[model samples]
Target: MAKKESYESRVEAFLLPLMEENHFELVDVEYVKEAGTWYLRAYIDKEGGIAVDDCEVISRQLGDWLDKEDFISESYILEVSSPGLGRPLKKEKDYVRSMGREVEVRLYKAIDRQKEFTGILSAYDDKTVTLTMGDGSAQTFEKAGIALIRLAFDF
Candidate 1:
């Protein structure tokens, strides 16, 4: 596995039990490098919402755990926070829960000259997602070609 994936998987494994114990959902974990520093970020949520205190609690525990383990070779900033409203759907559970909900989809390549679409999520499986567009057209998107799929929200 790539180093980033390896780090993220290890972090996910460690967080699984903590997540269950705390009644929190693990949205996503990422190990990424910015300008010069590496960052280990955990996105979490709950039925109601995540508060600052929740993030602080998780961050403290996770930081301590990472320190004790010391598996990662690089120094990184550890962050635990809520996946905001616009967070992309990156897992099966996310797709399942989003059924029948309106979603904004972004594709790696444009289809019909458009790379973005907004529609009701009608169906999804391991490889594809079907959306019912505003004009009642059903658009099937290959999951591999999708850059992002997230619940649609208006400000």
Candidate 2:
């Protein structure tokens, strides 16, 4: 577990400067094994949205750097892409960006007999989030109580 985290930290350190130079926001990085294959994925974004060309450029540059560094012992596939519309709010910046947006919140335990809440993200602080529900009432939840919180897509 520590080794995986160390690898992720190393990758983040390597990618941050590259991302900033290219005017991209480094959203998240994950090094995971799936289907017997190791994959390193970098999620990035910008003011509008990321293009395929952006991913291609970052991929080429980062791939070259990774090759030069030779940090990972195992073979891995590298992917650079945008975080989708429903991306989870994993950091303070994410929450700040998501203010006033509709969000779906799942809790570790039920609140008012409900485990999930869908509402406009009215406000958030370091310790709590306030959602304005459909009935015009506001619901406040502790940050620690939330299991997951992401942008909600209405379809």
Candidate 3:
């Protein structure tokens, strides 16, 4: 595996059981470099929501495990938190839970001269996602061209 993928996978493996035990859902795990610093972040959630205290509890435990395992060679900051309202649909369960919800879809390339669209998430499969727009039209996008697909929220 690539270094980034390996780090994410290892972190996820460590998080899975901890999540189940705590009744939290693992939303996503990422190992990414922003500017020059690498960050390993885990986003978690539950039926109601997540709070700062929840994040603190997971962070301490995860930090301890990472220290003991010492698998990552590079310096990285560890973060555990809830995936906020705009978090993307990154996994199967994310899609499952988001069905019939309004979502914003951003594409890597334009389709019909537009690259971003907001609609009710109607259907999704391994290869595509279908959204029903306000105009009563359904837009189906190939998964490969999607840059981000996330729940839509407004202030």
Candidate 4:
């Protein structure tokens, strides 16, 4: 597997249990280097909405746990926040939940000669998402084919 995948796996393993215990959903994790230091961002979500207190609490606890584990040697910023309105669909469950909703998807490679599409999500199995395009055409995309998946801004 690629290094980014490995890093994401480790981060997910380390954070999921803690999130479950705290009644928060783990939306995503981004580990990237900008300028000089590495940054670790954890996107989180909960019913109703996430508050500042929620982010602060998770940040503190996860920061401590990350320090104890020492999985990352480089200096980094640990951020915990809500996924927001255009939240990404990162898991199979997420895609399933988004069925019938408008979505914007960018593919790793072109499908039918297009690399991007904005349409209504028709269905999602564990492996693929079927999108109905503006012209009433449908296309199926394996999960691995997506570069990014997010809610579309209809307005």
Candidate 5:
């Protein structure tokens, strides 16, 4: 577990500068094994949205750096891409950016006999998140209680 985290941290450290230089927001990075294949994935974004070309540019540059550094001993596939529309709000930046947008918040345990709520995200602090529900009522939830929060999509 510690080794996995160490590799993830190293990868994030190496990618941060490259993302900054390319004007991309470093959303998240993960090192995971699926179907017996190791994968190192980097999720990036920008002001509007990230393009395929943007991913290509970052991928090419970061790939070169990774090759030079040779930090990971195991073979892994590297992927650079945008965090899609329903990406989880995991960081402060994500919450800030999501303010005034509709979001679906799921709790670790039921609150008011419900485990999920959908509303416009009104405010967020380190400790809590406030949402304006359909009936014009405001509800504030402890951040620690939330299991997941992501943009809500209407279809």
Candidate 6:
């Protein structure tokens, strides 16, 4: 696998169980270098929301576990935080639950000459998502066509 994919897989293996044990969902993770420091940032969240205290607790616990494993050789900063508004839709379950919410989606190829769409997520079914466009027109997109999907925080 590619370096980034390998890193993500390793980190996911190490952290997923920890997040599940704490009743939190693992939103996403990034291993990147910024200003000469490698950062391992884990975005976590729950049903309602997440708070600083939750981040602190999970960060401390996960930090202890990471230190013991020593999976990362370079000096890296670890961060655990909420996904916040406009959170990514990482899982199929997330897409299902986000029905009726606004979403922004990018497709691998243009469907009807457009590769991107932003609208209300009217429904999500077995293999497609129905979107209500700004003009009140509804369209269905196959899951395989989606390249990126995220909640649209119009607030």
TM-score of candidate 1 to 2 decimals:
0.96
Clashes of 3: 0
Which candidate ranks first by lDDT, i.e. highest?
Answer: 1
Candidate 2, residue 92: the lDDT equals 91
Q: lDDT at 39 for candidate 6?
A: 88
The ten-residue window of minimal lDDT in model 1 covers 74-83
Residue pairs whose backbone atoms clash in candidate 2:
none
Is 4 or 5 the stronger prediction by lDDT? 5
For 109-132, candidate 6 gives per-residue lDDT tens digits of: 997899989999998867888899
Instruction: Please give the RMSD of candidate 4 to the true structure.
Output: 2.7
Tell me which of candidates 1 and 2 scores higher on TM-score. Answer: 1
Q: Roughly what TM-score does model 5 have, to 2 decimal places?
A: 0.84
Residue 18, candidate 1: Cα error in Å is 0.9
Residue pairs with backbone overlap in model 5:
none
Clashes of each: 0, 0, 0, 0, 0, 0
Model 1: residues >4 Å from true position, as ranges? none
lDDT of 3 by residue, 52-116 (tens): 99999899999999999999999999999899888899899889989999999999999889999
lDDT of 1 by residue, 34-62 (tens): 99999999999999999999999899999
TM-score, every prediction: 0.96, 0.85, 0.96, 0.80, 0.84, 0.74
Candidate 4 wrongly placed segments (more than 4 Å): 1-7, 108-114, 125-127, 142-145
Backbone clashes in model 1, listed as residue pairs: none
Q: What is the total number of backbone clashes in candidate 2?
A: 0
lDDT of each: 0.95, 0.92, 0.94, 0.86, 0.92, 0.85
- Candidate 4 residue lDDT tens string, 1-155: 76656767788888899889989889888888889877789898888889999999989987888888886766787878898888988777687778899999999999679999999999887788889999999988898889999989855
**Candidates 3 and 6, the one with greater lDDT:** 3
Cα lDDT over the full model 1: 0.95
